[model samples]
Target: MNRQTKGVLLAAGGASLWGGSGAAAQYLFSTTDISTTWLVAVRLITAGILLTAISLAHAPQQVRALTHQRRNVGYLLAFAVLGMMNSQLSYFLAVKYSNAPTATVIQYLQPVIIIVWLAFAQRQWPRRIDCISIVIALIGTFYLVTGGRLNTLTLTPVALFWGLWCAVAAALYTLLPQSLLKRYDALAVCGLAMLVSGILLIPSLFTIPWPHLSSGDWWLVIYIIVGGTMLSYTMFLQSIRYISPSVTGILSAFEPLVATLLAVTLLGTRMTVAGVVGSLMILLTTFLQAIPMQKILNLLGLKHHY
Candidate 1:
């Protein structure tokens, strides 16, 4: 296959695994006494160890060098706590309170959040297309949460809170690693961050009562850590080598699509027509941010005066 084909496949596979993992998490929450705290802690620690080991085997020198740079180490620490840990915990908490599809769709708002952040940081107004995208995102979110009724909220307030927090945390997860990713091997940076975050959360695990997991449950857990976290991340990163990030970002939409499908089919999660429309609108924001400005204006039948 061509390089582009390979990248597409890799991106799709990674997204599918991520979506499947979310469904798996929802299943665990509904059927078992598994706490989000325990699951997030275990997923991070185990995945951290495995990814770190792989990085050590591949580039031991880089991993060691990273520890000696205090500034970079500080960055890594912040990324671990504020970025990685927050995103992981908030996402699962959202899944716990809401269904996987809704949480996944809400979390996809990261790009819109990132755009607003960048515009503010740069002190430049966002392009007209970007402004439109933001407005669409807001309307989409309203439809999603309220199901077109101003007085009603489809999701509980707690779920909405964590879902929005998950989006912010995910934005941080992408933003905080810029320096580390540029300076060190991506694998090394990610592995170290994961390790640190996992280690920090270990103490809390001790305080929470352990629930017994069956062999089937164990296998699902293993799938989540290995397939969902480690392998999916690896594939998603690797795809950037073969395709432009814009295309890869577009393909990442598969994550929510798969999650919605699994949630509806296997989990029997219901969605109103407005919810589906809202989901599509929100997902479209990602595409809007990616495509050219002229094309967007044309699609909207608006003249691009600027």
Candidate 2:
């Protein structure tokens, strides 16, 4: 396969793995009585260790860059706080308070925020296709959230609030590192971010009750650290080198769709036709948003920026 093809596959794989995270977390939670904070702490610590070891093995030069660029390291540290630590913690907590499908759909709202941020930063408006996509996505999200029955819009207030927080965290994770990426390599930035997040999460470990965790619990933790966090993130970073961020973001729509499938297959969750239609609408919106419609417009002799 070509390089771009490989990158697309890698990105899709990453999204699939991320989508599976909900199922994995559910499995772990079923096997253990671990709290969200505790789970986040453990996952971060383990992922940090694994990532550190990998960086040392394959990219020692990237690790060295951190020691030399103090300012870059500081930015990465801040990114870690919002992107790694807060994002994961908020997302898992949202799932805990609400259902996985609801949390996943809410988290998918980050693409819209990304487009808005990009437009604001560039001082331009989104393209026509993007506007259409956004409309489709918003309509879809409304239906999905209400589960097709508009009267059932009585969502759990706590779930909705935390889920919105999770969306904000997701948006920050997508946008905050653009400046740093201009200066440093993605691996270096990701490594430093993971390390910082791990360090910040350490304080929580002291407050969390540490009892003897069961064998299954330990395995689930390991799976989440290795598969959900580290591997998925590495794929995402690598994908950006080959594709535009818009494309990468759009491909991420697969995450929620895959999560829904996992929910049905692994968790035995059921959905109505309206729910499926709403999910498709949301996914379509995200995919439309990801495509470089601006470039297409430019090619077609249209004068617009997105």
Q: Give each model's whole-structure lDDT.
A: 0.92, 0.76
Pick out the ten consecutive residues of candidate 2 with the lowest summed lDDT.
Answer: 23-32
Worst 10 residues of 1 by lDDT: 288-297
Candidate 2's C-alpha runs over 4 A off are 1-5, 118-124, 211-213, 240-250, 297-306
Predicted structure with the largest lDDT when compared to the true one:
1
> Clash number for every model?
0, 0
TM-scores, one per candidate: 0.95, 0.86
Q: Which tens-of-lDDT digit does each residue in 31-86 have in candidate 1?
A: 89998999999999999999899999999988988888888888999999999999
TM-score of 1: 0.95
lDDT accuracy of residue 286 in candidate 1: 91
Candidate 2 per-residue lDDT over residues 1-306, each given as its tens digit = 887888888788888788878667765555567878878877777777777778778878877876578876777777899887888888888777765666787787777777777788999887677777678878876776687676786347787788878988989987778888776667667766777787787888898887457887777677778888889889987898887778777778767777778777887677767667776886676777667777788999987766
Candidate 1, residue 27: Cα displacement in angstroms equals 0.4
RMSD of each: 2.5, 2.8
> Clashes in model 2: which pairs?
none
- Candidate 2, residue 157: Cα displacement in angstroms equals 1.5
